[model samples]
Target chain A: MQSIGIDDILDMESRKRAAFINCLSGAKATNLIGTQDKQGRTNLSIMSSAFHVGATPPLMGLIIRPDPVPRHTLHNILETGYYTLNHVNQDILSAAHQTSARYDKDESEFGATGLTSQFVANIPAPFVAESAIKLGLKLVHHQELAVNKTHLVIGEIQTVLLPEDAVADDGHLAITEHGSVAVTGLDTYHELQPIARFKYAKVGQPVELLGE
Target chain B: MQSIGIDDILDMESRKRAAFINCLSGAKATNLIGTQDKQGRTNLSIMSSAFHVGATPPLMGLIIRPDPVPRHTLHNILETGYYTLNHVNQDILSAAHQTSARYDKDESEFGATGLTSQFVANIPAPFVAESAIKLGLKLVHHQELAVNKTHLVIGEIQTVLLPEDAVADDGHLAITEHGSVAVTGLDTYHELQPIARFKYAKVGQPVELLGE
Candidate 1:
């Protein structure tokens, strides 16, 4: 076993520490955020920090890093107050990962990566035509973390587009069935193999495992 | 293909909507957050909302639901200012999921679920003895999501314990090598199948694929 303390983490090189600490929280969902500046030029960037905020109003939260790195996606989301989240499946994994490259503001990632961007229902943001599952959200909450200045942006789900068959009768979205992959650290992608699904958990009672 | 709008989502039953919308953000890391009240009674709860906040100071964030749900984990963190996040692996998957059950205030989930509680380095919280990877963090930043009152708790990593061999030479942690799994929606846990790791993405340069 290995034991590392705070001093050990802080003493390491920046990128190495980033990689070490990044994987500590475990696997994260990889999504390509689609946004467009006020002038309408589009931007696409990949993020692994998206998390469920709540369900009643269907809110999702994303953490955007502060300056020094590219801020196009965060910029466009704040500029337009709307953005799209497109799941990065095997079909577009490489292209989706390429969206993280630092591109000039004048260039659109769609054109750079050869991925098509489709405008749907007048959402003012583009959706990855190759993505299996897509989400259209309106920025409903934004606040900066005092600890790091990274932005915690929460959005309300306005639209969700996915294959009808992928949605089970009980409303469980069969994401892995549609090729959606999970990400770890900063750049590794993994395929998800279904284990079993359990029914709503209750105290002292065994949870009934269900099939996908 | 299915297209769900906000109105459609709001019209569905609460639990169904929860299942539907929870999958939108993609798979999340399932972790056992261990904390203890001021009186030293330990509490352990399963959480899927943990996300990487940043790496410079080594911060991780967890979104805790407001009142209605059991918040013993959140309450203990607030009360003691320290908590431990232990990765959920196959060995403890069922026991980990079982921790979500509503337990008596005096009953520790660790005892009820048969998971061992091991206190390390005077952190004021217990670490899951069975977790392959564990972290001790101090509460650093916290705020409520004005949208739904769900609290966003950020903690700084103070200590880390893991198997030495799971770390790659380039600093990426090979989590799947340690039996860690990812979770979708609420109760579905999936095994991670190694796909490939990509080098740091760069504009116009073809990213190099690295093997685990």
Candidate 2:
């Protein structure tokens, strides 16, 4: 086995270190966060930091990087108090990745990347038209981390849009069935293949596979 | 497309709602968080909320549900200020999932699940012996979310252990090559298949595939 201590990790080049540490955690959810500023300029950026926060209220949390410069996505979300999370499918991988490039506050990533933005359910924010599964979220909480300058933005789900056949009778949505993809580090995309689905685990019992 | 509004979502049964909402966000990184209490009782729990917080200072955050009952994992981390994050691979999926079952505080998940506990560099916390990649972390910051009763525990990377062949020359670790898996919703695990790897994106330029 190989080991990397703190000192050795610190000695690596910045980009190399970033790649090493970022990919170390494992596969991440890939989505395009769409927000519209008060002036109505739409902002779309690729985000892999979004994670499930809770279920009762349907909350999701996203980590926004430290603000050394102005962050258009964060700014727009704060201004409008709403944003859309659009799954990044294989067909839109390149365009979604391109949204990460730094663009002026006035520039819209939708136009820059050739991705269409469509409003849904009368939500002020725009959802990525290319996304098969889209979510409308209303900001409920935001906190700046003391350890890092990044902010944890939490949102409550207000609407869900998906194909009728995407969801199963038991309420599980087969994400891979819709062609959604996963990401590792900053640039690598992976196709998801469901290995197994187990029933709710119980103590002193053998695990049961779903649909068996 | 079928749409689910907030009213319909709120009306579903709790377990079904949990399954639906949890899986809606997308694929998540699956890991086993290992911790030891002051009494030296070790705890292992499957966690999908682990996400990269930052790269420079090398921080990661795990979202732990509120402790209505004693949470061995949270209690141990708070008591010792150290824990280990071990990747969940295909070989350990069943055992890894079993850790989620409610176990008595005195009973170690390691012993019950048949997973070996190995300590390295005297970290005081145990790592899953069968895991291909493991990390030792020190608690840096923790905060309670007001929206949900969950807590976000942030940790700094202190030590990293992986197989010698796990990392590529360019610092990219092909997690899939290590047989690490991803999870969605609550109980579904997916095998990862690499689609494409691209260089960092720049505005107005075509994305170049890695090694091209």
Winning candidate number (DockQ):
1
TM-score of each: 0.97, 0.97
Docking model 1 quality class: high
lDDT tens readout by residue for model 2, B129-199: 99999999999998778888898899999999999877766678888888889999899999999999887
Check candidate 1 and list the clashing pairs: none
In each prediction, how many residue pairs overlap at the backbone (N, C-alpha, C within less than 3 A)?
A: 0, 0
User: Candidate 2: which stretches are off by over 4 Å?
Assistant: none
Model 1, runs deviating above 4 Å: none
The candidate 1 chain B region of ten consecutive residues with least summed lDDT is: B203-212
- In model 1, the Cα lDDT at residue A19 comes to 92
| lDDT score, candidate 2, position B49 | 95
